[model samples]
Target: MENNSKKIIHKGISASSGKFYGKCLKILSGEHLILQIHISEDEVHHEIEKFENTIYLTKQELESTIQKFSKELKKELVEILSSQILMLEDPIFLQNVKERIQKKLENAPLAVHNTIEEIAERLSSLGDGYLSERAVDIRDIGERIEANLVGKRSDYTFLENLKEEVILVAHVLTPSQIIHLDKNKVKAIATDTGGKTGHMAILAKNYNIPAVVGLIDITEKISEDEYIFIDADEGIIIQNPSLNEIKLFGASSKTDFGDSKFKPKKIAETRDGTRILVKANLESESDCDLALKYGADGIGLYRSESLFLEHPSNNPTEDEQFHAYKKIVEGMKNKPVIIRTFDLGADKFENEKEENPFLGKRGIRYCLQNKNWFKKQLRAILRASVYGELSLMLPMVTSIQEIIETKELLKESKDLLKSANVPYKRVKIGIMVETPAVAISPDVFTKECDFFSIGTNDLLQYTVAVDRNNSVISDLYNPYHISFFRLLVNTIQIAKKQNIPVGICGEIASDTNFTILLIGLGLREFSVSLPLVPKVKKIIQVIEISQAKKLAKEIMKLSEEEKYLEIESYLFNKHLLNNLV
Candidate 1:
């Protein structure tokens, strides 16, 4: 801070939503402790053996961490940390270190450091900030190896104790750091690294800890015990705050997130009595409280990836997966639990390398290729189905053959269960209508699948050929693209014609602005982020479904490109929508 009297307010993107006034604790980055020294030829062989052991132990540790951590911790995020495992498995990385030890007679730790650091330095040469950040992953892997080489393992145990509450700031916040952070002590979180949808952010949200990320230099700007106020909803940080700012923040904090009155009524209905089925997208049983708090109709999309992530070595054992499914199904209180089976990257399971992993063997394709794992999950879900109204959903179904194979496998699973005299219930089968081929061809899947959940995120990405993860051309991945709406309208029309219950269960469904538009498009079932359900309910309670239909009718009429602008203008206009915002 510049002075005692002066106030400084900085803004970043909100990673988690809440408000808090506390002292900022700058969590410094871990330092690498590799010494550059050439070992005697006598010790070179020993160093080589030590290096090999470290790699095995580090990979084992990564697997153990996945098994130990709460299922609430995102399993998909393993891809981030799993990159380290890939690096370890990379022959070049291992060869570089070994050659350094053998040929250059360098110490194992020093050899590992030089090899990894050199690679990291190369990644740093790339101009892209995202790729440049790969240096951190390299360093993280190096640190793990370096620690193991020194016969010591690294951890975040030091963060468990705090004298007072603080806004925890870090140069690069890891998922492990988020897990070890004491919620009572850390009132908020700020990081120079991380995005809103990153694993750390999701964990922070689960803990209800206010967090802001992508600050670039927040750790550089603040020191330990510096009084600061964080408004994570806006991703704003106030330094050297005035008394008035504190007072204003005090009142604003109450309504900043959902307080008492903000809770939604049990049933959501439009002005003219158009009842909408409002549900939540959940990761694990841990999110049940928030879903219930927001009065969710059911668990819309229970991504089953977490359980598979738990057993990163292979697949979660059937019993392990069964317990998890049962808990979530029972947690939802028999409403409905739609579990989407392992929608993982194609590169995850196969020995084949994919230049374009997204479009390769993924989701249902991966399951079909690995039927043993698929059967394990099916049997588990079937066993848990008796616990509640459970539904099994398949991801990335471009053809009807995938569904047929799944049904055959599912029947096989039931037969095995029946042979063993194990009790189970037959669950409803659903397919994620995301592939462009199937999104507009609902008539094709109508006979095979029991229900449809339009995964707008993948649907939009595949239809427009935009990779949402790529920063470049991501702007072109518009949900309101005329063709997107056209495809969505057609999918819904065909499904409705066949009397199939369909709903939106993608990231696009979370936007409150789209609530009216979705309702207008004849989508009465909405499974959005749990926190946003209350807001969507409020929107539902105000807008007449009649007006929603009118808005949809007009949006469909705008056949030209940049039709999204016209739709946005329509929605944002105060006079047109009339308190719709």
Candidate 2:
């Protein structure tokens, strides 16, 4: 770790892709590292009272934080804090801490700490990295409560005083901690432990901050104010890099991007003159703006869950939702904005616990169960449609009956708006083809909906019976599987026969390797992340439709066992597998 010694390189998983060179700023969560304290039996009741008061105070602090950032921060960022607030108020989490205080005759802080550790341990033991990552949130809440009991602040105040930009190096950062940091002062982020789906990681991507996580001992090896080079795209961190190395890396980074030469183009077309519309999946206002900057054809999937998450205590009023949607619609001008209804479950909305949340009441089903909430969102989407071209998309539709019921409710919403004499436009309705049940028979859905957006993330998961979040079986979740390709082809063909527009808005869509294959499968529209627009567009412009079709035909003929290797070998040999992601 000497400054004058040889440059040290460490590797980890890439959470967000970008390159950054900045000084290191190490952070430690002191509140969560408190020493245990003992208490007598008589102090049990008093301890429970102390714990309750701490919880109450922590909730107030979280609410105050949410209020402070409600208007200034992106809705998704605010939601991450709101989710933490919900965790603070969770009955099971609160009740367990209290029981530990009373039954174990421990102090308030000790009881809270022990309960959190126990729950986090159990979560990690589930053998699912995604579920285990939730333990970070749990630990964050417990630390907040403990900090309140100990009369200490939950955030690291040192971050506020930093005069220069630096790459934050930490063992782990809670979502709230990341939010509390001065984003302008933090050039990038590197963490010892975190998951891609964690709130901290999500914030990094949303903010366009270069970050790498799960670097087991980065904080230990990296020192304060050390010059570090973060090549997040390759998941490498160089500590105390030499001047020659720094210059070489900087030149290489600039050449790779070619900022001056690479201009954003409007049309994405193939060599044979087939035009493919490349859109962006947006979650917040900033994301909408970034999409436009990246030359997105339109906002393909405008997730409304962030709006709900922004106001955890209550559903956003119809007027509030309308204004929110209107801003994005107006911003996009002539471009279509497909706003999806809230697609979360009770776990996020109601803060209710579920054993298997993926299969539980979620997406459109949750909206139907809570009809009033659904009506408010529908009314909002309809009211905003007049501002620009807009569409309404339903998520998690497993049956035609769900679509039928939703259409009826949409009518009710329109009627209510009509009664109010509100100026609105009729928006096209669409369904997200995520499950195999829907993908297998998309023709039935095509008959009822205006369009079909294949969500390959869930479709592949549901079709292959593998959880994408579970790192243990992540290898088993293959997008190259012949079964997945068949499903994609089937859905696209069914939609094509009906003349219904079909687009893919999933993780796979953003992948450049799959772009040619998707185009070959007759998919003319793609919705990817903002950063991926240029690369995907580049791939589309270079390939011819006929060549892609030939590749697709060759792929479809391979056996289930041979498809994976065959397609991979084909793309590799053709040099179409070059890293663009």
Candidate 3:
């Protein structure tokens, strides 16, 4: 271990944004449990029995955990655990383990371990971060099975037993392990593996836990119980910090979204008093409450996919969807709630697999193909609209014809509700500008749709023809590309000219670096994650709209490589770097 009195800082990628000061607790990986175990031919039957029992036990454990944590954790985390439970019960995985144990005369634990290794290797070799992260899930299940067979449960007992707060340092954490953590004791998390989209990362954000992931060899570098400071917003881990550094971090840690510095008036406005509607992009009812707590003007993007994904065995009924949508709409108390129809098929529904899923049947296209499911969702939205202000938005819409078809479906749904004497309010309809075709010709949509929400994440991916999840080509997925900026500017300009309400509900909307640029492009609405509402609000409250326009004009003239540097310099000169870091 290094000197505890010395100040040592390490930098890595920021997975969840926050600050924390606590002792480090290093967690060991399950790789050590992969040792070989030989068994005689006659013992193979016993081993198979043990394996089957262990599988059953693991499934029960996951189900119980899911039931226990379903309400306590975020909906997404619960769904992740549910998926793992399904994997444990998967026939293919079970058969493979059984075949290895019976044909090779191997011990159950070893057979399970080998099967997981093979599957994990194949998943990791796909070169997609989302799929690669599932490898962790496979290993987690394998470890659970092995632990059950050995009559020992290798859970986060250390976290459960902790008396004082600590920053968990580990090679990686599965979604279940992360959800099972006692947040009261685990103040923050630092992982040597995993990316921003990993299960652990999502859990950290959903639970409001500060985390810094992708810190290579973090477990090896930090000693147990050593006091450290984690600045998750900047992705910095300071080990053995000096007294002054500790004081600074402590002061900064105390400042959060709740601080008066970030709190805005009833409306979000710049220093020059340019009003910008800062709304929240939510997934569940809890998120709607969190958004209001964080001072969101309204719910901009209410992702309806969770309702379907949560119940993989069956689609949510019309009443289930109506109640779910009503809860958010009524909670907002007349605040605008834009409910986006299920953006399914692409990495969402396991049944809908494609060679190129990104460009295949997804979003609006998937909903259109499954017309009954689409109409059920529409009917629910229409029924819920009477409770409060609700708008229906379609995702991945590329053509005016798609909008026309969606309107026809809406009419049919409304007519059915009318015939049944189920009163429904007239809901406004909108479209997501996610592809180049929509962005290039915003005028076509302005006439048909009530509003436009730019999905920059998808738009960028489509514009550059790069897979954002592919690490090898991630650098090419640049948002500062001149083409993307021009498209964005053009779309915003068209919306403004047509007097159409336009907003951005993508990763870029939450980014402080692009906040000024977006404001300069005349975007008056920003729909971001719950935690980002206050930070973006603070940024909007500080910038002058006229200056932002000037900055945007200057940025528009730069080449792709120069834009990043220019923005960095501009932010530094304006002293807005503090808000970002």
Q: Runs in model 3 with CA error above 4 Å?
A: 1-207, 210-262, 346-351, 560-563, 571-581
- The number of clashing residue pairs in model 2 is 0
Residue pairs in collision within model 3: none
248: Cα error in model 2, Å: 28
Q: Write the residue-wise lDDT of candidate 3 on 398-420 in tens digits.
A: 88988899999999999999999
**Per-model TM-score on C-alpha atoms:** 0.62, 0.61, 0.63
Residues 358-433, candidate 2, lDDT per residue (tens digit)? 8888999998998987888988889988999999999999999999998999899889889989878888999999
lDDT per residue for candidate 1 within 142-234, as digits (tens), equals 888888888764655567677787888888866556666776788889888766555666678767777887888888888788888886755
Q: What are the lDDT scores of the predictions, listed in order?
A: 0.78, 0.78, 0.80
> Between the candidate structures 1 and 2, which one is better when assessed by TM-score?
1
Best candidate, lDDT-wise?
3
Query: Model 1 — TM-score against the truth?
Result: 0.62
- What residue runs in model 1 are displaced by over 4 Å at the alpha carbon? 1-203, 206-263, 312-314, 559-563, 572-575, 579-581
* TM-score attained by model 3: 0.63
